[model samples]
Target: MAGKEGKGAVKDSRINPFEDTVQRLRETFRTGRTRPAEFRAAQLRALGRFLQDNKQLLQEALAQDLKKSAFESDLSEIILCQNEVDLALRSLHSWMKDEPVARNLLTQLDSAFIRKEPFGLVLIIAPWNYPLNLTLVPLVGALAAGNCVMLKPSEISQGTEKVLTEVLPQYLDQSCFAVVQGGPKEAQQLLQHKFDYIFFTGSPRVGKIVMTAAAKHLTPVTLELGGKNPCYVDDNCDPQTVANRVAWFRYFNTGQTCVAPDYILCSPMMQEKLVPALQSTITRFYGEDPRSSPDLGRIISEKHFQRLRGLLSSGRVAIGGQSDESDRYIAPTVLVDVAETEPVMQEEIFGPILPIMNVRSLDEAVDFINRREKPLALYAFSRSQQVVNQVLDRTSSGSFGGNEGFMYMTLSSMPFGGVGLSGMGRYHGKFSFDTFSNHRGCLLSCSGLEKLNDIRYPPYSDWNKQLIRWVLGPKSCTLL
Candidate 1:
């Protein structure tokens, strides 16, 4: 019995690969190595170098995992990370500065400001669909905020995972950052341990699990979950223009994006027009044979391929439906005349499948969209501004695109995130830094103000009470 107990203890000690790693990172963070703006900028610069020096390797890994092209890799993943790093480096000084606040009558002479402090240790869990962008983008923010970050790259994308594990850590400070090396089991084990903050980008179902675990330790979490985003088309719009924009964004990244329009809401007549227009756009975007197109990427895994294949049977295949399981290649597809009760409409279709449903009128389209959870992104197409405004005013989403797609992500000034089930917090530029940092309210009062502090202490008469109330006016702060 003693030998058996000893053997069990040995296995349990080695169960979580991150136990030692997290401990070491926590120790390093306590040393104040990551607190200064200079050190933070240095790490951000090193991260930028990591992206530049290993651009080819990253592209190759992405190709191996998702069959992504060099152009797509550069445009979507590498460039985005680089831009984030550059922005962080340039803005680190100002971001680190203490922000002053308006003072009240009592504290007029005292210094008051909000200081942004690091949360110590952070955990970032990335999704497989965008292995690089999703992982590094959050890391950029965490590091800029002077937090020791542990990056958990998606295990499903093994090629990219290998690079992130073996290559990424070499570029940044080893003491402040780590790349977790394991699968789902290891991830679950790591979650058992507490973290200061957790930033997760994946499906909503998994997001709940992360939040539940974080709840035990009272750790704050940012869940970047995916949802069924809707794109509405009005009768007064150009079919070809809308089709081109929607098709490009939908099919971008093989339709694996979280913000991609999952389905279309339009009238029967508009659906009829969009069907042919979308067909032409798909053919033009990816030659006659999409399977042969280099711009097109394969599904990240066989499990995802099978799941997407199952959704293909939901509605009538209006445009492209051909798929090859052998290569994990799913052709850009369009489903028409889909019912709201269908499986495609029920969940986030994170594949190259776009389903179009018929609505009788604009009010009916709005009603259909409002029936489900709010989407991460909502798009409406119309030549008239009033028609677009109506949809915008009625619906609430994390973000909106008027006759466009997720192009808003390219700008560093614009913050990105979801609402409700789609996601919880915003991150992209300054928002990312703020998400990881704790804004500490601070006030450094004058050291010689002892006499003023004693306002009728232990002898609070009616006159003193009235004076206190009068001093704290409507516009003044109640903090006094």
Candidate 2:
């Protein structure tokens, strides 16, 4: 009875948690306490401890939201968040170091350096796919960059949201980091307010909305959106190795991963070999009936269950098409003979369903992928360097991987994000810290050079003009 009343009250009030977050952050920034590097380090360590102590809670939250197994949750979400914390903790001093730049010909008389300064406040809207890591990791970056952050965890994953709200405050300074929980309406309300930077990871449709909303404030945004991530099965790759990797990705969190291989693009002969291997691999991993298998995960909710059900109406099912509502499980489904017009082909199928499409040549697959929206990730499985280069040269995606699936996300050195339609900006490790910071270029000029600067004064002369040309123009080859 109270739940119904609470729903009505929420609808009537339409109160936005972000408003509170921004208000608190503004007050915190005014204190000038966060300017110290020591403060940032302390907070980061606290965050690290929080993740370590509450590993089980995090795991259970993911299970409640996505039916993710303990092992998969650790690999994909919890451990990654912890890794980001460790990375920031270890390298923060280097990131904050004042980087000097060698002066160009014109600026030789001046000293120039890039100072990485924190943006005052940042907002991160995380997706449900990897809810724990996506939200926490961005907040980690914001903290390391010495910016106040307001994290809006996806409400769809209520279990994760609950843990975050309960646990984050204990470890983090409430003013510097605020974890807000709500649905799309709450996110929409939050987007209305301006922030120095906004990091979002979700669907493309919502990415556009986030962009459009950010436009009102002229805020810079980092959008990490999904695409029809392609996984090419070339003949050269070790069939067993490729199959094992592919199967692992396809079934990880029941294929509810942003970087999960959405479609497999391969030759007819390769498909014949790949299909059987994939089938055997799936069986080996999850056993004969995924519906009853403890290793397999269930759909996040009824809405998604319906979405997957609709895709079946249009596409021809090749393997494993089973569902049990009581268990909230969908078997590892593989579809062949799927038309480009089908719904599965149209959108990012964020489920355990995998689609295999036969192509006449590599060029055909590349053209087909290019014709659609750019993906957040495109994976090409090939042993041949030439085939890898062909995929890289012909297609456009947010990020690419060779002979692997979803591994690009693991690299802290490399930036993680998407391109057009897939996403706008990049984040991860140092890249993320920089994303939350603004590199302010500072130039120092010598007072002794004031006489030399006077040569370009308002009193014009032929000699002055020639000197100006020589100074302003591109340098010549001869040494003085």
Best by TM-score: 1
Candidate 2 residue lDDT tens string, 444-479: 887686777777687879998887777666573112
Candidate closest to the true structure, highest lDDT: 1
Q: What is the C-alpha lDDT of each candidate?
A: 0.88, 0.81
After superposition, which runs of candidate 1 have C-alpha atoms over 4 Å from their true positions?
1-13, 477-480
Number of clashing residue pairs in every model? 0, 0
lDDT of 1: 0.88
TM-score of 2: 0.93
Give all TM-scores, in the order shown.
0.96, 0.93
Off by over 4 Å in 2: 1-20, 447-449, 476-480
lDDT of 2: 0.81
